[model samples]
Target: MANKTAPDSPPGSAGGTPTRRRSERSRRAILDASLALVGEVGYDKLTIEGIASRAGVGKQTIYRWWPSKAAVLLDAFTADVDEYSAQGLPDTGDLAADLKLVLRATADEFNDPAFQAPYRALAVAGANDAELSRAFVDRLLEPGIRVYVDRLRAAQEAGEVAADVDTRVAAEMLLSPFSQRWLMRTGELTYDYVDTLVDLVLRGLRPGS
Candidate 1:
C-alpha cells in the first residue's frame, strides 16, 4: 500500500516534488477525485481537500496540475483522446443512418447514471462559472461537436446531404435535440426517439410537403 497522504498549502500553493511515477499517480488521483466529488456534491460544496481525500492524494498535488477544480475535471475528460474515437459514432456513409447512430450513442452516454451524474453536475457548475463553462465546452463538448461537423461536411461532398444545406447548422440540428433532452431531463433518451429525430430532420416533418 502506498502512503497517499499529502500536506496541502492552500488552494493556490505550489505542490511537492513528486517523482515521475508518483506524479502520474497523483495526476490520476486528482482527476478521479475531482470528477467523483463533483458528481456526488454538484460542485457547490466540492472542496479541494475533499478531492484530495477521495483521491488518496494531497490537495497540493491537484493545485500543481490545475488552477481550479473545473480545470482538473476538464483534463480528466480529455486525458484519453482515443476514447472519443472508440466510443463516438462510427460513420457508415448513409447520412440518415449515421446521424441516428450518433444520436443513439449520445443517448447511451447521457442516460448512464455513471456518466450522467458527473456530466450533469459539471454542466450545472459550468453554468455558474464562466471559466468552468469555457473549459467544459473546449475540452469535453466542442471536440465531440466538431466530429459531427466533419462527418456532415463529408456527407455534403459525397452528395448524401442536400447541396445547399448548412453543414454546421445541420450538424447542430441533429445533435441539439438529444442534448436538449438530456440537459432538461424532459424525456427519456431512446433509440426510437433518435431515429425519429433523424428522419424528421432529413425528410421534413410536414405531412405531405
Candidate 2:
C-alpha cells in the first residue's frame, strides 16, 4: 500500500492541486521580493540571489519560472501596471480637467524614483530584446494607451471632442510627449509641463475651439 502524502509536504507531494497552489505562492513571492529589492538597491544592483533570499525560495525555483532577472522584474511590474490601467482615465465630464488630472498622476509616477527604478531597468531590457519588448507593449503600454483611447471616445460622445478628430492619434499626442521627455531626458517633466500639453491638445481637439 502506498503512503498518503501530507497536504503541505512539498509542491509536488500530492501531484495536483497542492503543487499548483505552491507554484502560485512561489511565483508571487518571487515577484514581490524582486520588486522590494529593486526599491531597496535599485535594478542595477539587484540579483537573483537577493530575490531568492528575500522570497525564501531556492534560486532554482526562480530560474525555473523566469529565465532572467529582467523577466522577473517585468512580471513584478505587471501588477502595478494593471492597477493603473484598470483605474483608467478620469471621467468628470470635463475633458481638459480630466486630462489634466491624468497627466498630473502620470508626472507623479515618472517623478517617483521607486517606480522609475524598475521601469528604467525594464525599458532597457525591452529595448535589447525583441520578444520582451513585444511582451511589454502588449501587457503594459498598449493597455494603458487603450485606456486613454477609451477616455477620448467618451469625450467625443459627450461633444467635448470634435467628431473628426482621430482619437488614436489624439491619445498619442496626449501621452507621447511625456514618454519622450522621460525616456530621452529631453526636458524636465512637471505637472506644469503636462498641464501645458493637455491644454494644447484640448484646444486642438475640442469642438469649435
Candidate 3:
C-alpha cells in the first residue's frame, strides 16, 4: 500500500512540543490514517497498531502520545476539527443566506463516509457509556454547533429573527433535521434538503413576517 501523506495538508498541526515539528507531523499522519482506516474498516476493527503502521510511525510513538486506540482516535478527531471552522457560516448580513450556508456545511460533514464511521460508532458507543456520551457532547458536538447558536442570536439581535426566539431551541430546529436524517437514514442529505431546512427554520423564526 502507498505510504504517502495526503497532499495539501500543512506540515502537521498544532498541539505538541514546540521544538519538534516532526512530532506534530507524526501525530497528524496517525490521525489521518485513523480516520481513513476507520472509514474503510469499522471502528470495531480499528487498532492502534494498525494506525501506527499506516501512519509510518512507531507503535511506541502512538503509545507515547495516547493511552489507547480510542484515545488516538479522539486526538485525531480533535486535531482535525479545526479544519471545519472554515466552514462556519459567514455573516453576509443576509440571514437566510447565512443560515442556508451553515446548514449545508453541516449536512456536508454528515454525508462524509470517512466521518460517518467514527461518528456512528461513537453514537452507538454513547448509549451505554455516559462518560463517552458526555465527552462526545462536550468535545465533539458543542463547539461547532454553538456557531449556529451565535448566528441565531445575531439574527434575533438584528430583528431578522423574532425577539422571542430561543436561540438554543432555534439552533436545534436548524440542526436536528440533518441529525435526524443522517442518524436514522430517514432521508438523503443534499443541498436541496438543506435549503428546505433553511426555509422551514426561517418560517418558524420569523414572527408574521
Candidate 4:
C-alpha cells in the first residue's frame, strides 16, 4: 500500500518539514481534482485513476490518503462546505431568529452553482449506493443537521421550546421542507419561505402557557 506521508523526515529538523509540506499539498490537490472531476464527469464516471491523473500524483498517493472514490468525494464536499460555513451555527439567544439565519445561509449555499453541482450529484449517487450513502450522511448531512439539534436543545433549556418535544423530529421540520423544495425545484427558496418555516416551528413547539 502507498503511504500518505513522505518517508519519515528527521524527527526534529527543518530538513524534513518540506517533505511533510509536499505531502499536504499532494493531498489537497487530490481533493480538488476529485471535486473538479465530479462536476465535469458526474459521480458514476469518476475514478481513482482519473483523480490521480488530474491531480498529477500517483494512484498510490490517493489510495494512501483515501480508501475509495466515495471517500474522496465526501471529503471534497465537506472541505468546500467548511470554506462557506466556517463560523458554525449561529446562537443569538433567539431560536426563531437563529434558525432563520442558519436556514437562509443554507439556502444561499444550495443556490450557489459551485456548491449545488457537487451536492446534487452526491445526493443522487447516494440514493443507489449504500456505502456512499452512509459516508455522505455521517460525514456531511448529520453534522449539518446537528446544528439544529444543538440549537433546539438550547431553546428547550432556555424555556423557549417545550421540554417534551422531540428535537430530532423538530429539527426535521426546519430542514425537510427546504430540502424538498430545493431537490424538486418546486418553489423558490426565498428568505420568506424559510422565515415562515421557523415561525411555524416555533409557534407549534413553543412551551405552553
Give the winner by lDDT.
2
- Better by TM-score, candidate 4 or 2: 4
* RMSD after Cα superposition, model 4: 4.3
lDDT of 3 at 141: 76
Model 2 CA lDDT for position 43: 60
User: Candidate 4: which pairs clash?
Assistant: none
User: Model 1 misses residue 22 by how many Å?
Assistant: 4.6
Model 2: how far residue 181 lies from native, Å: 0.7
lDDT of 2 by residue, 4-25 (tens): 3323222321235765666768
Clash tally, candidates in order: 0, 0, 0, 0
CA shift at 203, candidate 4, in angstroms?
1.1
The predicted structure with the larger lDDT, 2 or 4, is: 2
Q: Candidate 1 on 1-209: residue-level lDDT in tens? A: 15344333222223455644566677776777777778888878888889889988776666755677766777767765436744655668787877776678778877888778878888888889897788777776777787877877777687676677776786688778778888988887889888888888777422233
Cα lDDT tens digits, model 3, 14-100, are: 544453566667877888898788776767788888998999987877776677777666667766455665455578878989777
Candidates 1 and 3, the one with greater TM-score: 3
Task: State how far residue 21 of model 4 sits from its true place (Å).
Answer: 3.0
* C-alpha RMSD for every candidate: 6.2, 5.4, 5.7, 4.3
**Candidates' C-alpha lDDT:** 0.72, 0.81, 0.75, 0.80
TM-score of 1: 0.79
Worst-scoring 10-residue span by lDDT in model 4 = 7-16
